[model samples]
Target: LHQFDPQDVNYNMPSVLQVSGPLDVKRVEDVFCQLIARHATLRTRFELIDSEPMQWIEDTVPFAVEYTKVQAAGTTADTDQDTTTDTYTRVNIEAQQLVSRFVRPFDLQAAPLLRVGLVDLGVQEVEQEAQHLLMLDMHHIVSDGVSLEVLTDEFVRLYDGEELAPLRIQYKDYAVWQQSEAHQEWMQRQEAYWLNTFQGELPVLDLSTDFARPAVQSTAGDTIEFALGREVSERLKELAAQTGATLYMVLLAAYTTLLHKYTGQEDIVVGTPIAGRPHAELESLVGVFINTLAMRNYPSSDKSFLD
Candidate 1:
């Protein structure tokens, strides 16, 4: 998909971390370099090999932190008290702009799809601590949410001068195991289960919208936020416990009920992401190990919530 749509930035996972007190820029850069050296996915790139798309992991990749120092804006003699607040605001704006620019599409054929940037906001007299914003951007092909957490934890450990234990296995080892004959048999069983589940004609959900459907599908959309109060949340949890179902199952039931009410569809299929790390060895590795699970549910007006 990335190869076809090279301009899309949707797969770019960007994160920002704020560091307080004094910071060593060189040490931070070294920490990033160590992280790349530790994780094989960090040095991976994709290209066509024998007419098939394949990933190649390089032994090493050059990495450096792009540092930017933000200067405080001039303050009038009368606004000395507001200088700290004003400086913070200015730093925030500059940091946001830098992140926006840093989050661009990556070339799949290029190794080290990761980019790091640091913004030094200097020291504030009120806080008496220097602040720095660290930005990390990586392609989704090489990393996922869990991988980002691993990177952050390892980064902190390295910066604090703690030695990390060598990994027993890398992502490449996991990939090799996935193609083994034993894994193939297990995968075939799963394939059979899904084939049986979706054998019949699937129902198409048709929810009424304000405007006519476009000729082509679009990634553009808007989001609305709503919260279930504490009482309702607790009640839902209690219901889940009583019914021996997870909170996710209970919430999914409610969501499907809403869809049935809106579209009058009895059968609905929804897709949700699942962490695909099945082995203990894969837990600490930095890689894209996520899979989508398709859930098919039947909701009827006559059935109670429990049913």
Candidate 2:
């Protein structure tokens, strides 16, 4: 998807960590280099070989941390009183801008599709210590949510000078196994299941939108964050347990109900991600191992929630 549409930034995953107190820039840089050395996915790049995309891992890749010093936007008249406030506001704005810049499309052909930036906010009056922001930008082709968590845990351990256990297999090993003859039967069974499930004409979801649908699908969208209060959350979990269904199933059922209410359609299809790691060995590895599962449901007014 990225190779065809190089302008899309949806696949870019950027995260920021706030660091207080004195920071060792050299040590941070060395930690990132060590992480890249440890994960084959960090050193892997894709290229077109015989009209097909093929990924190859390099023995090593050069890594660097881009550093920026944040200063107050302009001089304030009340230097003593407002200096600290002004400096903090400037740091926040710069941090936002830095994150915006970091969330950008990556060149798939480039090795090690990960980059880091460090923003240095000079010593603060309250903490009396320097502040820094560590920004990490990675392409989704080589990572997912689990991979991020794995990277963070390993980063902390490596930074603390703790030794990590050697990995028995890398992502490339999984890829090779997936294409091997031994896995053919399992793959064929899965393929057949999906083919049989959607054998006929698929229904198109036509929920009302504020604006007319565009000619081409867009990857652009905004996120709305909300929290279901603790009471409601616990009730939902209880309901899931009572019904012998997982919390995800209960939530998915409610979601489909809402969609049915809006569209007045009985049949609905939703896509959800599943961690594709089927083996314990693949759990701690950092790579893209997520698969989308299309769930089809039928909602009816007469049927109860349990049905």
Candidate 3:
């Protein structure tokens, strides 16, 4: 935000929830609204006042869940022109259009940076089978991945006609607590540790690349996935036990070791996310409660892998 404009309209978080079953549209809408009303963060918007930012919570946010029908393959009439093929092609085209809108940036000033859409999977009034695709688009400023899981759980419970207990405090209450004098003092106490940890000139990681690096950073990216075999996974567990450390710690040590071998830089700092919700009451709340902690590793050449 310090480097870019606040209203750039390029920052957004999107997720899709695929649900297959009997879908009650009215019930789902009511439960969705209840979910937003129960959580203050969902109904929050940011604004600049006196050159500072402040959160504005709306009493009610607009219901923006759109419903569209997607024709099922082999369900169309058997005409000479093959109506089923035509229907399938049309549905695929419409679905792509919906996906394009799903990634569009949201307006931060608009309260409730959430929009939902339901895609009917050939469910008609006379048909017995019912299913839907729940599309969700939200701004990262107001939420994170954890928020998505919380909402999904609540929606399922509400759809099952179960009552949810009222929250004692909301995210706004936490924000207010952060401004207290005691909190400021607590925050200051950690300054010395961070300062000492990052002392001296930071080393730049010169990664070996196949192509020239760009002058400006870009969000355009993709992910690759790989999995360790069962035997290797069990060995990793055994290694963690011998070292008296957790699996995560052992894996992190291995990662830092790999980086040290690749870049020949032992003073490595790796960033990992931690859930900032320390209180049990805040666990079920839907909000962005995460902080990144930099883990500095200085592996010695004399020590073994367990070290």
Candidate 4:
């Protein structure tokens, strides 16, 4: 985020969590605050010290909740239930608005880079229950996809009045340990292997494009959805099993093959992201534990899919 322009939205990670159940505003607020208090990463901030980046976790950070109520026509097919239709429509619109507000960029210096919003879905007459949508906005600097899941599970447990056991170590502690002498020695042992693997100059991939590339890349992007047929899925699995390779490796190899065909480049490099948690104990920690590794695959014209 620091490398990009101030207004760039590259590091924003907005998540919308919709739940249909009765919600007590005060209880929900308390639970949300407790969730932030429990995780040190949520309260961390980055700063420059002598031209080097460093992290510091605040003892406590401010937490606030914004609430909104809406009323609109509903979309239920029941012609006689006019009121029900309006309630459902209102809920849907409000939920969308909440999500829109959640995706805005955050200021790194503003510690406790998290925001929470609540939408009250009045009441459901049939069940005599209330529904709600909880939206959370976070910066990618401190949290990632896996960390969000960890937060959700803990939030549920805390809301149920279950006390959580203390964490073995916080993210900051792990950061300090990574730079220690013991860790450096361990890393030094593998230096020769990495040097040998990446000895040559890396090759750049030149993909054919219909349109000219922009001077500066845009952060705006959308997801493309596609589905694999059951037969194809099974075939891929069988091929992976026959070759003693995992499904991900099989898929990656196929991707490399496509690039080789398109660009006609024998030396191809593809980047894949991996969960960087080296220790079993780090699995439960909520923080940025992701690393990207470049895969250099040399595909020959004679190589078959199974090979």
Candidates in order, TM-scores: namely 0.91, 0.92, 0.89, 0.87
Best by lDDT: 1
Looking at model 4, residue 22 earns an lDDT score of 69
Tens-digit lDDT track for model 3 on 202-291?
Answer: 766666889767897777789999999999999999988987999999999888888888888878889999888888988888888878
lDDT of 2 by residue, 199-274 (tens): 7777678889998878998877799999999999999999999999999999999999999999988878899999
lDDT per residue for candidate 1 within 185-267, as digits (tens), equals 99999999999989899987788998777878887889899999999999999999999999999999999999999998899
Ranking of candidates on TM-score, top first = 2, 1, 3, 4
lDDT value for model 1: 0.88
Question: Stretches of candidate 3 above 4 Å error?
Answer: 2-10, 76-93, 123-129
Off by over 4 Å in 4: 72-94, 123-129, 189-192
Looking at candidate 4, the ten consecutive residues that score lowest on lDDT are 71-80
After superposition on all C-alphas, the RMSD of every candidate to the true structure, in Å, is 2.3, 2.5, 3.2, 3.1
The local lDDT score (0 to 100) that residue 11 gets in candidate 3 is 55
Q: How does candidate 3 fare on TM-score?
A: 0.89
lDDT digits (tens) for residues 9-37 of candidate 4: 57777777767676777877899788778
Model 1, residue 217: what's the lDDT? 82
lDDT of 2: 0.86
Model 3 local distance difference test score = 0.79
